[model samples]
Target: MKVTEAAAQLGVSPRRVRALIADGRIRAHRVGVGWEIDGLAPSKERRALSVRSWLMLGRAVRSRALVGLSGHDRMRTAERIRRLRESDRPSRLLADWRPADAPAELYLDSLTARADRADDDYIRAALQRGPEYLRSRFDLAEVVASERAIRGESREELAERASVSARLVKNIESSQPLTSPGEVRRVLRALDIEPTALPDMVLS
Candidate 1:
């Protein structure tokens, strides 16, 4: 189908359709003065073109937020308003622009997690821990505490990453006592510490 026809059938603008084609997300080829798209392809082609404008608006918002351009960056935040006039989406997001402008660092951290297809808490925690935060200790529990301290991450956050209770993390860090094999593995894995390198036993 022609780009314009595909855009119309998908209930979006030709501009968005062209953008998708350019990004190689949509299967298409340019010929002569126009482009052709395989609207019926099974490559998620017909999955859902529903988010065209919404994604446009979202990209705009994220771009503006990245540039620290609060309430500005109309293409990302405002241009679509004229097309979809008086919609609640823009109004709602606009209301909380301040928070989105600065955006918590965890938000992007979570995004990186999602990008890696990492669904487990331990993996998320490890990514958040980062390589620079790795510790140099050989003791089991002390290594755990050192790992957490090096990252400057709270017990609560580490607990979430390990998918364990915060109380358990605290106890491990404080008492330095031995626990079940599984619990030790979970905590160490969350901290990105090699389980075999530091067993549950105390190191001399």
Candidate 2:
């Protein structure tokens, strides 16, 4: 497909497609004199939205407070919008983006309970505790917080990297009695950090 056609099919603009091609998000091939799409679309069917973008769109779609978006269409919409030029896209949707106010303990507790109830050994043990599962179970708050302290990554950076906020990070960090386990894993995963490097923390 021509860049223009590809853009239309993706519900984005020609320039947006071109930029994505340049960024290597959407693969393209050189034809006679123009670029042609190399595949049906990018390898990933849908791009995850930044937490900020999600909040903005949620605001426009309704009134009063709302929780996070669920399911696939939201994923597709986020992918389409992310590839578009920011200025050329729709009006700014989010007010001032922050993380959802879900209590970190609640999700972590649920995950722990499930792990305890499961009878399997390795799978149950890994489920009982692992970086990916912990992140999902805890709504990714702890990971966000540690990044803030270590790297000073903003809400925007965290959103881009893992789709959450500084407030969520701070909350998780301050979640007294310290539900630090989940975040410990989250921080390592988010920052591409290796566990062996943290001998002090690990030994302690």
Best by TM-score: 1
Kindly report which residue stretches of model 1 are placed more than 4 angstroms away from their true locations once superposed. 1-138, 197-204
Total colliding residue pairs, candidate 2: 2
Please give, for residues 83-190, the per-residue lDDT of candidate 1 as tens digits: 222221222222222222333444433433343452334322322323232222224445565446445478999999888999878777665455566766788777
Query: Which whole-number lDDT from 0 to 100 does residue 31 have in model 1?
Result: 85
Clashing pairs in 2: 56-93, 56-94
Q: What is the TM-score of each candidate against the true structure?
A: 0.30, 0.28
Native-referenced Cα lDDT, model 1: 0.49
In terms of lDDT, model 2 sits at: 0.42
lDDT of 2 by residue, 6-117 (tens): 7655545677678778888888898987899986553343333455554443432222111243345444333432332121222211111222442334433343344345
lDDT scores in order: 0.49, 0.42
Model 2 Cα displacement at 7 (Å)? 0.7
On a 0 to 100 scale, what is the lDDT of residue 133 in model 1?
A: 27
